[model samples]
Target: AEKGTDRSTLMDILWDVQRRKRYISEDDIGKIGQAFNMSKTELEGVITFYHFFSTTNRGKYTIYLNDSIVANQSGRKAIQRAFEEALGIKLGHVTPDNMFGLYRTPCIGLSDQEPSCLINFKPFTNLTRDRVFEIVTELKSGKRPSELCDIPKSIIHYTPAEERTVFFKPYRQFSSLSILNTYSPEEIIDLVKKSKLTGRGGAFFPTGLKWEFCRNNPSEIKYIICNADEGEPGTFKDRVLMEEHPELMIEGMIFAAYAVGASEGAIYLRAEYMYLRDRLEELLSKYRSQGYLGKGIKAKTPFDFDVYIHMGAGAYVCGEETALIHSMEGKRGEPGTREFFPVEKGFNDRPTIVNNVETLCAVPRILEMGISKYLSLGTKATPGTKLFSVSGDCSKPGMYEIEWGMKLRDFLDLIGAEDPCFILFNGFAGECLSEADFDREISGENLLAEHMQFRFKDPLEYARKMGGIGLRSGGSFMVFNKQRDLLKILKNVADFFVAESCGICVPCRTGNFLLNKKIDKLILGHAEQQDLDEIKEWSNIIKITSRCGLGKMSSTALNHAMLKFPEVFEKRISANTDFNKSFSLEGATADYDRIINEMTLDYD
Candidate 1:
């Protein structure tokens, strides 16, 4: 093992071991334990947490069909069935020939282009029954992933490219990193602060203060982390940035490393993005060859910066910074108390700075252009543009970057949303608002003429007028049309929470399951008013008492749905008769519901 190798690199060793031998044998585990000076029990515990790494032979190829809300909406079930029929094997098991293993995976951040699946982490999106059959045929003939079919085109902007970007537009086209050298670490921090940048991973922590804290915390060894583990159901903006704008995102990471005086950085990428790993590593090698990554790359500079790309094995809670650190360390992806934040003691008890992919991508641009230029794009408190992953019932479903504080209605119209009924502002764990909301059509188009601008003196006040704080989403905007069933959508969101609970704390681990059960009851026409009251009570307990943010906001979609669309739930409640008539519950909901809402599967 290298000197930098420790328990944190346990996942990497396991990944390599599995790749080389199709499984981590007992002898290999013992040898890895000895190499890292870790106990075999500790190694086994780490290995068991993630679904990807296995101690036993999985198969020659692992086929992961994404069983997410969007996947089901886009007909993943039919596609999955096609795959099984073609392969002559059931899911979650290998074929009789021991050639393939099929399994269900959570959201793979391809909501806009679903139904999607991963063959050994190489994504094939926009799936259909015919495509599945074609893929299986090719695989049977010994075709590689790249030879199967062309990867989907980059899901970049929905609107015209002319209006989308300030830096990324030109930079990705022509600009290389200039490696700004005119400022000290404090000076760079001041510039970022002046830009008023915030973390885009939903927390909205001020970027400058985060960098300053990491910089102030002196340590012999320090780290910077670019969080690209975007497991949120409706969120795929990070995927866009990683695929279309790798250089820009990498430059951002490099700038953060320079600002925080750290040499090492890592992109904790989601396992679904395994296809991106090769291209990004090639780009990084180009950076190193161009004298950008290695020691003293800049003339007369003492900075030494380089980064590693680490893949996560399908854990949504790992999106949290602390939990991300633990996952990178080859441990279970569970968040800890904020008392010892990653900035103070993280990733093997060293000062670490973790920033979202968008935030890290913005750092270099802020340093390149003057902070004033960057600040001019967005609002007073919220500065700079935001990228939203817009899917569902929209004509232009893809990634769209807008100046912050765009009116909800204008955004809707701009994205060509048809009959915009309701919109999910963030992911499954985020908020959902509908045209039936308090200020339904505040997009200013309806307030005045269809072609008029929706000007506001203050964007925050405008958001308050239109709806709640959904305008400040971390960048997921799934537009649901009138044809979409609100009850089914709410249940989908509830079931996602149930499936993704990290199981570390009971309030979340148990509360989310019970919440899904209550939703199921309503869907099944078996619920009285008591179920609603109990659900509300359980939601409060989970939100207040859960150990992490995943649980704290797990009930947002359900709570909002019940409050805004009470009639949807009321219609499904049992009639005055003993007969139940709500089995549309089974057919109306997405296919993922059947998997998640199965009463036979018990969780501790």
Candidate 2:
């Protein structure tokens, strides 16, 4: 805690080392361990647990190509092959020239413009074979990557508050940290509940209740954690909020700390947003300089709360609250059993409340304009507006904030999703609703459950329907047109869960692996009727027995895709019934076979 800040940052040290030296080394690890008073093995454990922390300086420019579903459908396979052939180096390897390191990442949040890559954390989207070569030529010619960077203006198209609230109102305005002195902590909690605010981080937990729990938990210390590790694929709204309106969020955190009796607050941002670190640090220092932060903020109340940002090192599972707590404490970012929630025990075993980035961003608006005005904006069940990251086959593929309960069809038309046939709601871990559900409203209420409730008068009779998929999103919705392959898309979704699973529980570890294998068999047309039954069995087992939310939702995309698009698999089975591989193999090996034959002429 030296530097007037909580410096328990393993991820930060690793990131600093990687940026400075291109990679981390064992000697560097020893020095870091000694400086931080940590075990050397523990330091290495943290590095290996994350995918972004590498140990070798393989190349000067690290190229992370997007291998997500959106990219693949947009001809990422051909683009990857083109890069391999042009560079003369296979993926996961650096060329002898030490120019580039090719790696595959899940998603860099640009599902709108697919076949994308991040050269040293800068995004380059909508890549063609020619464009890849052209960019490579520039990189090789000592050109900066930022020269080719495509920075879009206002990724969030509009602010919901408009001219009514101060969120997106004016530039560098004074945040209402002074307003916290006007209300007691209990009254503040009542205002949040009156606003009917809930967590926007997928779980839909009540934000007010969460704060109330930690506030009443009687501890020597408490913490407020804004979960900004927006690792969900196709989600980039948080990045825009964090980069553009960070002060609004910081003000929210300070208000939250005052309400919950927390001395410290932290914002855990993902490592992919590493470029914004210096700007955020400078903002914090500026606030501290003005007496809005550090001891006795505004000198009105004893709310000595300051916020810090923690970087997550490429683990999607850390989006879960408990797993995030573990990462912040310099341990493996894995979820623990949920007997005691974070409101009871979290972040150094202190009572803590974890709010999502959007949730925090929305807080300042509610506090300023009063809770009634916020509640009047959206549906009865879910009040206020929410942000959505719309991409995939959309004319305007960017962020938008709208009042909830809008028709799905109207949303598609507004965003210009031409010929939209499918909806991948809330990334791979969320639902896959079909075109038939276009008329459905995007609200907090689950439409399938509502349908079941109204259709069947009896609660027991509701179980008889084979069921349909409903969208319950945490503000991520991706649309794919009819030209995309449904089965292959599901396979990509399955592969993401398989790659991202924490493997802490058996159901997530083994179940997601088997689920992916079944998808592979279905894609290859080698699956039997028995395989379908086995998939159902495994999916149910994983959903029921998984220890954490990630494991429980691991098979969600597959299950929903199968329900909505069963014909994709059924047609593939008939096409592969009389599979012939001889001609295909021969066609692929034509040129290579002739060269090999010439080399072995004496044997021939």
Candidate 3:
């Protein structure tokens, strides 16, 4: 093995080894162990733990189909039918041409992308039969299609001519999310200060600022956490980071540990990421044994740091900082208020620092590239690139990283999305956008401002309002084509929110449950104008009164449904304006009883 290949290289070696045939045998394993200087037990542990690290040959193009709620809603079975019919293969079966391998993985964060499929390590979600065929044909021909595929002739004439710039390229290899191992606290801090990198895990907080805050705080045993539990719907960018560059994450954690005076670090990864977890653990062991970690000489100065991987027991709410801390402590993953930020009172009640997986992963580049260079590449307020899981109505769906301030058109083009019918920013519970919002830039300031403009409008006006509604933290845009029923789509989204909301507060728990019932009633061809009015009233009340960001965002579904897709509700209301459409007196109450009964899946 070559010396000083970096932590990520070790993971690459393991990945390469797993793809070989002879390595499956005991003798081959021993030889491989000797080559990498690893024990047989360690080698075997790594190979067996991960489901993806196969000893047999996988085709050049491997496909991972994730079965999740979004896929379920979008008729995932239909997507499978389309792919199999088009490709001449069944689930988990590859084509004879060796051009593709098919397998099933769990959900990627982008539920909209769920029923999500990976083609040659790239993601494509929100698939339709027609779209799937287009993708397969394009791939089969070895030509990657671009977002221009979705442009209608009416709109095409309005678009500007494609222009080239000196500094910017239309495409480039995504910068590897890796970092050099460093021990010195001052050195690590200096690197962070120079990189001008901001955290990719929601909030877009400047990473260097976070380190500076934790470093200045008075705490002897500070804790640093990498929030790897990517639970948001319509977002799956983090998983790619883990599978492709596990060591960059570790190096980032180590650098953060040093900067903040943290001796130990923990990665709170989601249970769904079992494959990534296995690969990461194997990489950690190998890197440690090679003196890449611990005191006295992985490289130069002495820096003692170690990382532990803790699996989360699948809860969406646990993505919150407080809840994550609770989960790590073996407690119920419920959140408390932000009276004392995690930086002041975190894990085990010690001064702690929690950063997202993407945030930690970006640390090394900041060290390598220096701050001024980093700052010059992105917008002034939000420097550095943002990663997005672009799926939904787009033809070529995948995770993309682009510098801040890039236009929405450029972004969609980079991700190869055809024109979107409607874009749902943030997560499932966020606002839905019409063509009116397409030209707007995606950024923290723009999203916030757009949402607030809708604060005082009628339902439709409010829905149409731009800004303040997009994903500044974590969210994906779900695209809907003209063929799809917008009303049914909104109801499907409402059903998911009602099902997932933890029954903590009345607004979220009871209120959301009721909202879904009303939407369902409208979809079933029975509802009154009064019913729609009541739903809106409840949305406002719950939105304002609910605790945490989840509840506040939950109302967005109802808000958008009323404003953006008013015809769905208005059609029923106009027919029953006289209040005589066979709605029983107990129609509202009885539905609640039924919903409560079916709340939990295991309520036997």
Number of the top-ranking candidate, with lDDT as the measure: 2
lDDT tens readout by residue for model 2, 287-309: 88887778876523566778788
Cα error of candidate 1 at position 267, Å: 1.3
Q: lDDT tens digits, residues 199-249, model 1? A: 778766667877887888878688999999888877888888887778878
Clashing pairs in 2: none
Task: Estimate candidate 3's RMSD in Å.
Answer: 12.1
Rank the models by lDDT, top first. 2, 1, 3
Where does model 1 exceed 4 Å of error?
A: 1-5, 25-31, 34-40, 158-164, 172-179, 299-301, 437-472, 574-576, 579-604
RMSD of 1: 8.0
Measured on C-alpha atoms, candidate 2 has an lDDT of: 0.76
Model 2 misplaced stretches (Cα beyond 4 Å): 1-7, 30-42, 78-86, 126-134, 141-148, 152-155, 158-172, 446-472, 579-604
Give Cα-based local distance difference scores for all models. Answer: 0.75, 0.76, 0.62
Q: Write the number of the candidate with greater lDDT, choosing between 1 and 3.
A: 1
Q: State the lDDT of candidate 3 residue by residue for 285-306, as single tens digits.
A: 8767865555542433445677
What's each prediction's TM-score? 0.87, 0.86, 0.66
| Full candidate order by TM-score, most accurate first | 1, 2, 3
